[model samples]
Target: MKLEHRIGQLLLIGLPGPQLDLMTRSMLQTIQPGGILLNTHNIEDAQQLVELTATIRSLIEVPPIIAVDQEGGRVDRLKEIYSPMPSADLFRASGDAAVAARMGEIASEALRTLGFNVNFAPVLDIASDDGANNGLKGRYLGSNLAEVVRLAGAYLEGLQHGGVVGVGKHFPGLGDCALHRVVQQDQCSLECGDRRARALPGLRRSLAAPLVAVQEHSHGIIA
Candidate 1:
């Protein structure tokens, strides 16, 4: 690839609508971004989504990483057309690794049918029972380090087995902080030394796994 094209491949961009407009087509034709992140705003239905993704693929030489945040609960992008999925809390509550793995497989197949190759999911954050204020909340796997590790590993395996890439998110943990609703108060900051120290052991355990990748969230390193 040319240097310009190579540089473009490093970028993962977002679209505004259900279809590719002229400007978007031109940009994709020229730059050929490495991936695209689809959100709720860009999806109207299953058919429309498939067409949109197809159009995007046709515009580029190599296939882009078509990603969506399908972590279930409040973060699903395909819920309008697909069946509602149980939150991560449910998986953790079940205490069955097989069930969690099955959920991952089901979610992955659904995404694959819609032309999505990547899912921003299997949130590995460990949140407490009183973590309603935490950014992860119901999306987290579990508070126990051992349970989190086992379930996340199984979930990731299922996702990959079903032909979709699973991305584990919010590294170094997000359980200690609330979701940021505004920027003025710096509520999103991860500067609490104690929280960082407390989270390190779990973070190290998660990093030891060869199957997972760190997601880019709140200054968290993507490994």
Candidate 2:
């Protein structure tokens, strides 16, 4: 690949509508980005979603990665057409690894049917019970590191089995910080480092397990 094309592969961009407009088509043809991440604005229903993704894919020579934040609960993108999924906390409460795994399987099936290849899910953040102010309260697996690893591992397994790739998120951790607001970069780094230090052992163990497959995406870097 040319250097320009190689650089384009690093971008995973989003469009503003359910269908590709002239500008989106032009951009895709020019850059040929490696992936596209869709949100609620780009999805109307399952059929529309399938068509939109198909159109986007047809524009590029290489198969592009189609991704969505289908983590269920408050972050789900398919809630309008699909059944609402329970929060991550609910699975942790059940204390059954299979529950998380089943949720992943169901989510993957829905996403794959809609032409999506990736699901940003199985939040590994260990949210506090009173984490509403921190923005990660109900989205987390649990505050217990062991439980988070167990549930997240199973969830990853289910996603892979269902033909969708799962991307574990908000690393090194976001349980204590509210990402909606701004903070000094230095302070942010310190907090993230602390959280990682506390969670590192469990993270290592989880990654070493056969079922875990995670990729990090930083959503709050100011640069």
Candidate 3:
């Protein structure tokens, strides 16, 4: 492969619109991105989403990483086509591993059918000590390290069962700094030091190298 091709493969870009027009196709062919992220704007309905993803995959030379947030709740990009999923806190509240696993399975099956190989879900971040909304409020499973690990593990289990690669996100937990600061500013670790340290234990327990990379199967291959 050419150097440009290798560099292109490192990118996971979002599309400008739902359909891939001539210009978009040409850009994709040239870039050959490593992945395509599914978002609300790029989605219209079930059939359209399926077609969009399929077309994206076909346009690229190598197998690309088609990813989605798919954390359910307010973050559910598929709410238009599929039922809204409950928040992460709700699952943690139940303290049921099966529930978490089933949520993962539900998300995985849907993504697989839609041509998505990667799901940017199962957030491992523990809620902040201040209990501020901090961007990941609804997304976080819980603050308790043990419960967080347990539920996240169950969620990963569910995702793996459905043959989808579950990507655990926000490593070492990012609840300490406000979401805005983290997004807009650089080195925004305000009051995040002690709390982030506390959160590392849970991440270490769950998302170690072995757990993060589950399968190398052709179906859910990620770059």
Candidate 4:
């Protein structure tokens, strides 16, 4: 693929199903997006998922990467009948890397079974002092950077072992920010040298993993 086409492939797009047929046709005919992301609103059931993916693939000259936010825990989108997963913090609370690995394996397997190739998950944010860092209340793996990195790495490894790609998110750290980071008004702990170093470990792990891509959260560079 040319650089232009390769760059095109990096784009992930969301489209409504009712209009998917037309929109996909247009994207293929025009934009030729590299991938399509399915949201809860676009999914109905197993058959629907298969049908939607098939239709979208048919439109594109190359098969587009299929993705979804199937993180177990609070951010799950595929919750029609699947078993609910505990949040990352809950996994860390278990204090067992094995348990976290198992959960990641299960999450990857479920998404693989559902025909999703990429899963946006393993939120590797640090959430210490829950009262002060309310934003990391649930999505966090742990407050300690070293432990968080270890646990998150285990989870990503498990997911990869299950043939599913894992993506790390909300870069530069958002654990200390108040809830809804973009709207929040608090100085992030990342400003602290040690805290900033903590956040990078998980990202480094993801960079080493054979992931599809890291979902860049909409936060401008702090400095």
lDDT tens digits, residue span 1-223, model 2: 7777788888899898998989889999889899998999998988888899999899976798899988888887898889998888788889898898888888888889999998878787776444445556678887777778888888888887898888776666666554444463212346565765577566756642343334453554422
Clashing pairs in 1: none
Write out the backbone clash pairs for model 3.
none
lDDT tens per residue, model 3, 96-203: 988998888888898898888888787776674536645666777877677777888888888878888887766434655453543442132535545555666556
| Residue 135 CA displacement from its true place in model 2, Å | 1.7
TM-score result, candidate 3: 0.85
| TM-score, every prediction | 0.87, 0.87, 0.85, 0.81
Worst 10 residues of 3 by lDDT: 214-223
Of candidates 3 and 2, the better by lDDT: 2
Model 1 ranges with Cα > 4 A deviation = 179-212, 218-223
Return the top candidate by lDDT. 1
lDDT by residue for model 1 (70-184), tens: 9888787888998898888888889998998888899989999999998888786666554456556678787767778888877887888889988877655565565444432
C-alpha RMSD values across all candidates: 3.6, 3.1, 6.2, 3.5
Model 3 misplaced stretches (Cα beyond 4 Å): 179-202, 207-210, 213-223
Better of 1 and 4 by lDDT: 1
**Which regions in candidate 4 have their CA more than 4 angstroms from the true location?**
1-7, 132-135, 180-198, 201-212, 219-223
Whole-model Cα lDDT of every candidate shown, in order: 0.77, 0.77, 0.75, 0.70
Q: lDDT (0-100) at residue 187 of candidate 4?
A: 48
